[model samples]
Target: MICAPPEKIFRATRNRPALARERARLARAALADCRLCAHDCGVNRLAGETGLCHAGAEARFFSAQVEVSDELELMPTFSVALSGCDLRCDFCITGKESWNARAGLGFDSFQMAERAKLALQNGARTIMVLGGEPTIHLPSALEFVSLLPASAKLIWKTNAHGRTQARELLDGMFDVWLADFKFGNDACAQRLAKVSDYVRVVQENLLWADTHSELIVRHLLMPGHVECCWRPVAAWLAANLPGVKVNLRAGFWPAWHARRHGEFKNSLSVSENQFAFGLATELGLNLIP
Candidate 1:
């Protein structure tokens, strides 16, 4: 089934070309004093000053292809993964590309949108703008939206660590927010991803996204963090956002620098997966594929 009707979102009226351009303009100007993410490095990207993401004024992408690896309803999506990220997750599968700012081809919104159109014509269900974290490249992301067809189903797949300015720029742009709620508490977040106040930031973004667009929360069940991370995440979702689609992702592999951490040296075990699912069910989370 589809995520939701266009009218269900509060910003339906503003998801147009003009609005995209306006948002793009505002995001482009924000490069002078960046506050797009919680890091709030205040670095002038326009002057080549690098922030936590290390991304410059322009955006770069590592991968773009139509894939059937997302949620069932939103499969066959043209996933454009931008390079560089706000958080440095040691277990990131795509760390080779995600952590490097200049790892790929320069982004061309016009060309990429055309490619996405082709994918849509060739059985793709949605156009997904993901990243290392797209919040850092707001201008390019909004520019791509401006070039896309108004009726195209757009998905913003994010880490959900964005701040107020990023949310302001992204208010009504996408049809679905496929966000990650990787950690349930600040301690795990800081220890694993080197990001502080992670729970507060992600919850705030999820709340805003639920109001502005269709939100799908995904939490990758890690090997040793079932209780510390997944339990609290499920409990919060059950309490604050009952019936919200929760993708309890069971695929957690030890990739990248995962060997750096003792717990992340191996993938989740069968017992861990079962335990995580059992907990989600106990909390009454709306688990989807």
Candidate 2:
């Protein structure tokens, strides 16, 4: 499943197929007893147990076509944010929306495909699949990608905590990977993302991305947590993955219980002068400045 060029995408979707019914079918089947994401809560979404992701059989979510402005090179990339994340990052910016998985509007697979179509119509060259962790709704996600024309390049933004599930989509389904290294150490990972094996899953999935598509690793610099938290993951990527691009995100706006409950109250955002960026430079990573 080599990623086809833009022209191919356009051509493939010249006469877009009607995908609503098939998407519905798959959604119903998957939600019957969902194992779509790594959490594998196995709760019957149709009965609406709302597993760890809080997503039910109904893919309720909010969507908008946004032009990502971070990467100058990818100037015209369109982004779609799906609601609900498996990990409740203390510094989550979209706390209002993603914290409880109840924030975003739910949409069917056809609706999602239309969003991608809208992105292309709006002059975007690529579509970014972001979420409450896209894997939360694996069947719908896969069906959405399958409906799109091959020429449309897809970039999946993930926590990289679900490599086995993520790997299932590696066969030419996605063109780029915009992944995150949320916790630098096991303790931080457990306390922060609530998953001690975060790094292990990410490392394995990253290797899969390296062989399959372009990989960009993003690390948010948390205040007072740089040395004890961000450095280990940064060093690991630099040594184990040389060509992968690194985005030392200076934006970690506090959200959720961060203002009072979590460890981020009165936290300061990272600037160009932050220490993490300097270490990334020293590590010889393909820094995204």
Best by the lDDT measure: 1
lDDT (Cα atoms) of all candidates against the true structure: 0.91, 0.68
lDDT of 1: 0.91
Give the alpha carbon lDDT tens digit for every residue of 148-178 in model 1: 8888888999999999999988877888999
- Name the weakest run of 10 consecutive residues (lDDT summed) in model 1: 5-14
Model 1 residue 274 CA deviation in Å: 0.9
- The segments of candidate 2 whose C-alpha lies over 4 angstroms from its true place after superposition are 1-33, 261-263, 267-273
Q: What TM-score do all the candidates reach, one by one?
A: 0.95, 0.82
User: lDDT tens digits, residues 169-281, model 2?
Assistant: 33455667778887777788777666656667778877877766677788877776788767898789878987577887766677666665445764644443367777877
Kindly report which residue pairs in candidate 2 clash with one another: 9-151, 59-106, 60-105, 60-106, 61-104, 61-105, 61-106, 62-105, 84-132, 85-132
